[model samples]
Target chain A: MFSNRRSDDVAAPRAGRPRSETARRAILDAAADLALAETCVPTIDAVAARAGVSRTTIYKWWPSSAAVLAEALLDRFHESIEFDDALPVRQALTGQVDALVRLLRQTPAGALLRQLLAAAASDERVARALLAQWMDPRRESAAHHVARGVAQGDLRADVDVELVVDALFAPVYHRLVWGHAPLDADLATRVCDLVWPGIAATEP
Target chain B: MFSNRRSDDVAAPRAGRPRSETARRAILDAAADLALAETCVPTIDAVAARAGVSRTTIYKWWPSSAAVLAEALLDRFHESIEFDDALPVRQALTGQVDALVRLLRQTPAGALLRQLLAAAASDERVARALLAQWMDPRRESAAHHVARGVAQGDLRADVDVELVVDALFAPVYHRLVWGHAPLDADLATRVCDLVWPGIAATEP
Candidate 1:
């Protein structure tokens, strides 16, 4: 669903029939569903079969299965994460953590994330995409929100925003990859409580 | 090699011809070599073939390939990590970090770690083994050293041991998995400086 159907920077719109948005969505959905169901990654053939599209069509754009799945995951994240400034900084950070925990518990997206992490461990392209599109960008956005908290004197201005971001998010990643525990609301709350004081440190 | 090659438990009189320790060492060396190649994780079949051992010989003990590799990694570490109390706590912590960074830079060990991490992300068995054998053991060992420092008034009593361990370790891991940059002496010093103060914090 996230694969760009059309190329950017074209001189003008092509006269040919536009790509079918419905087909695109089906491909992504099928990829997500297949990822959750399978042991190893879902092959492009499996995705194409599930989506009722030719393998050629799937491969026409995405360079690899990881790329397709990465886009699908991004789509899921974009739909789920809503930035609301009205909530207090603490409230907002807490909510983001909760939301992230909840989303990770979803079998398909969680499995996909694990797959991408493994793929990224070895593949440079997947690594760059993950860092740029999902990991760092998300952290930067969270830091921006946390900066507002610092401005309001709700958090320590001296807090290393990047470190604070890592403190909050890296644990989730670490747990998901290593801890073998479900990232539930209780765990999220504990993390926030443990980290909030340090992150919100202020001059006496 | 650490696999059940005639239990050391049985009295020598009862045991049949003892397994050749040299052959065991050779098998481990070959496994590490193949893993460093990294096109695919070396399977028991491949390791056996490379080592000129029977498949039954490998499976007679290790339930999984990860088990074999895990033992090999541990064996490598055993040769390197000295478990004595001769070194001062602060010096030990610093030296241990340096040793770990150096170990991760090894061609075969590095590849094996990456493979194990990928395996850990997907397989619960691999994840548990890697944690028990490598990660948790080291952290626990490090925590004890840190506790001794606190007792001696060389570290902060309130410093969260787990947090300190994670902070000290995670950046090195992040570098290992993400960046190609060498973990230089300067970076090691910075890590010590950044972490030692917090751990050494007094009521100032």
Candidate 2:
């Protein structure tokens, strides 16, 4: 999940000073922008130019454009997910879906993630970094809530946790990747409705 | 969606003689290979060299590397789907899923489609061509069979056909793009099982 190495490598100062948060933010934003704008992964030099930082800064901090992108993604979108166990299973999952739908549709995050997806299809490093830094954490969190649904006796205990979670979110992603339709709360409600019955616990 | 223009452009040769089917096949195969092997969309010249065809042949027939990539996609993986209306709805839909699973898991089609997906994400032309030639046709065909399921009263009469079909196949694609699991028959079975109950009508 590249989580461990990222901390050590990114914070190490080649300039005998800690890396500037402002400069790092600028670089990550530029990298995400360039990738979306160009419809391809941005180069380190290109990101530096856009960020108004020297090429040395980018090289000193991040290993590759993908590395910057992964970090950029974390900065822009990570830690925004909330899983309230107090709520019923459907509302808990629906809350996550609504939040994600907003992140993707209402901000630059969607364009940026689409660009990352494009990059991941072709580049192994990008794919690995993205899976570890972005997707796995979110998927794990979603699975956590869904697993709780089973343990709470709300969802079918015999349900496949991964499959159930995937069912909940796959329709949204299907639209996102294919540009087939809008990612809306309505779609989320409909998916929850369709999937809930299949996974809901059956009483004897 | 992109169905109209693709027919006009790809078939018409700017040159006096019609484009050779043999040459087009080579070009397409080479372009798809380059995208997967090089881990990016191949250049026109690279495709020309790989295909052992003249650069002019490629230029005369196609607009860009993405165009060639799109055409390559259509040529490589089109016309493999089956959606029989005669069989029971479950079996018929399962057959399509089974065929797609095989194409994705057992052949170069999966690699080719993944490469096209990457190209489509970044390149608008690739995206249009992919949707028009590859995705739309398959979706429409699948819709045809699904509608039959509705008409035959196997599926719920009130079902939203688009949403139902999306539910059926989105998980397969989610796994494809994410590489979380193998594209196999068991996944197909689970998806159908989860989805069928939601979409299936109660027996009278």
Candidate 3:
């Protein structure tokens, strides 16, 4: 789960017994499962009931339901996204996009992302956690990969890496929130093909 | 406001004079204004008080605050977006993007959009109304314009009109919901430039 941001700093030899890794896993699993249900974002009490843990234990770790579900989503997303550098830059971009589309299609993780998006719209703490702990980490890594293309002269050295990253990722996020368009591997491929020539150094 | 969807079908020629357009406008304005305030979405009682209309009058029209806000947001959005076909394809796209960015930065309309996004995430009715009444019509128009470029051989005829439209619009929406990046003309121009060559039939 992604809520580990401050855990490293604060967790060094905590005053009490080390937090139960088993309890944490139970809480996360229950939270993830509950989020997929046809209901509003799962309540903390509901999560506790599902996990068979006290409300105190869940609250002790996560500040809110969005935080718990975000971490749960990251658990799945982390396993799915694997970078493949052997392919050409365009293919590499498309491959990464392929993995991302899968992560979003899951009922639980997808719903969690939507809930976090709404929460982030209004709540700064939720916003920072999602951006810093989840999106930015992946985005920064993607930027670095893009910078490799620029450095190798595969891309125009002047190509804005940040903008390219947005070009690659924003449509997925946009479709996730709006529900107006299809979110699929084919759409991702089209996005890559259209964007590739713009950034490529040589004439298409 | 937007809740007018089924009302026209249901609210058949109500007694006590016809529904007042003046009262409707006041209700919508008050609803939009209250949404911008740092408060919960305006309640029927609150809106009625703010608009100086009876709660019965509000119930006679809008189903919810989000409905009124959606209509108000559309009012400004419709006036603001004017496409100019005289310009070339790329320039025309940029022109439309410029107007959209302006409408979103306004206090009331911008906040209403954010609130509605949150509402849409949780409520299917709100999502359907937003897509049906607000976004789809505009998106369908934008796709038509992109199709023009393809038909005229200005852009590669193979380009996907829907994907191009998504490329043109999604970054702005991504910025709106996430608040992670700047949403401005400069960003819009950069998006157009990156996407143009890939879609364009001719060399830069």
Candidate 4:
């Protein structure tokens, strides 16, 4: 399950005008567009101009251009992949991996992620914002799912849930960043099939 | 078993003077030092000056600063790891992972790698050079080792060696890039232990 809490909740309360969802949506949309098109991080001014909002309004809501872009990316990730706790554990894990592979390979979000990663390399603020707002939460969600599987006897109770989480998911990111291999459609299944036996509870 | 082939062998042979290994060492050493000391890609001019070689000399040997850095990195990787074909498959794989984790965590190579990754994001040349010269070769070597394991019946015959390579090694890279988890001393053993069950040949 994804968190409903807004990434911009940290914005200070202001008296003059209530924060506008319409304006916020516009800004985030513009930021996402700019990030997809540009190799460099989109500037606040560029985003404000594209969104047809004042720079003051942009800054009032988000601390930096990277923050805006991170939120936009987080929004897309949430929209693209939703955990189904109802499914069997293996199916659930494979589905999440499949969804993530599709999102990375089939969407503008992948290019945007590469750009964010590039920015994060130089900008500590970008790295922190991304970790805090997106990567950490996403990883924690997956970790929690793994822990539940262990608790339910679907996976080995002795397994380290966090390490299993990394083993299952990190290949996607590795291929994404390194480009040494392809993020093909079958990758999700291949990864899950290989990793499942390692974590799955064994027969006596 | 490691290839002794020099990464810089692709350098075009010139009519005038033979390529000096001492000068090449200086250039690569300077490039590595600058990469560790700074966030951005070190410039050809800076490397030339630091190595006490002419800009023309640097160009004669490498197409770009990235090429120099790539060769420098490849040199370090080769220096750091030497595979032992005599060891059992599991120990061999674990040793490779352990060496990589140490290289990434315990040396300036970690910072240098982060810089290369960041630069590779925008620079197609860097990506190509890294893939062709380093990532591809290193991966092929590991894949060969895995294939040998399968042939020896130490691992499941049905295992995809390439995917196995990715699963075993990608976590280190994922953590390195994303900083999602610690690259602790035990990570190599932990990863190998978890993944080994999935790949190991089982009795009837």
Q: How large a fraction of the reference contact set does each model reproduce?
A: 0.20, 0.60, 0.81, 0.66
Regarding TM-score, does 2 or 3 come out ahead? 3
Q: Write the per-residue lDDT of candidate 2 for residues B6-114, one digit (tens) a residue.
A: 4565665456534476787788899988875665568888999999998898887776787777666655555455554567888877766666777778666666667
Taken in order, the candidates have interface RMSDs of 4.1, 1.1, 0.9, 0.9
Question: Candidates sorted by TM-score, descending order?
Answer: 4, 3, 2, 1
Candidate 3 lDDT at B62 equals 60
lDDT of 1 by residue, B1-204 (tens): 222322342233334445645556667676766666663468998899998898887765465678667766765575344444567777878776677777776546755676788888778878877776666656776777778788877887777676666655665665556442345555544455445645664656
The residue pairs that clash in candidate 1, if any, are none
DockQ of 1: 0.26
Report lDDT (CA) for all predictions.
0.65, 0.75, 0.72, 0.80
Give me the runs in candidate 4 sitting further than 4 Å from their true place.
A7-18, A37-40, B7-19, B36-40
TM-score per candidate, in order? 0.72, 0.78, 0.83, 0.91
Off by over 4 Å in 1: A1-23, A37-40, A49-57, A79-81, A88-90, A121-123, A146-163, A180-185, A189-201, B1-26, B33-55, B78-95, B105-108, B120-125, B146-164, B174-204
- Global Cα lDDT for candidate 4: 0.80
Per-residue lDDT of model 2, residues A38-81, tens digit only: 64567888899899999887876766788687777765565455
State the lDDT at B143 in candidate 3.
Answer: 73
After superposition, the stretches of candidate 3 with alpha carbons farther than 4 Å from their true spots are A1-26, A37-40, A46-61, B1-30, B33-41, B45-62
Model 4 C-alpha lDDT per residue in residues A1-204, reported as the tens digit of each score: 566566445654564334476788799889888877764568999999999999998887677898888887777568545677787878877887788899888777776677777778778877877777668767776777788898889998898877888898889988988898889989999999999888999886
Q: Write the per-residue lDDT of candidate 1 for residues A1-204, one digit (tens) a residue.
A: 122422221123244325545556677788777776673457888889999988887776566677667666665576344567787887777777677787777655666677787888788877765664456545655787789888888887777666566556655666666663446556556566656655664567
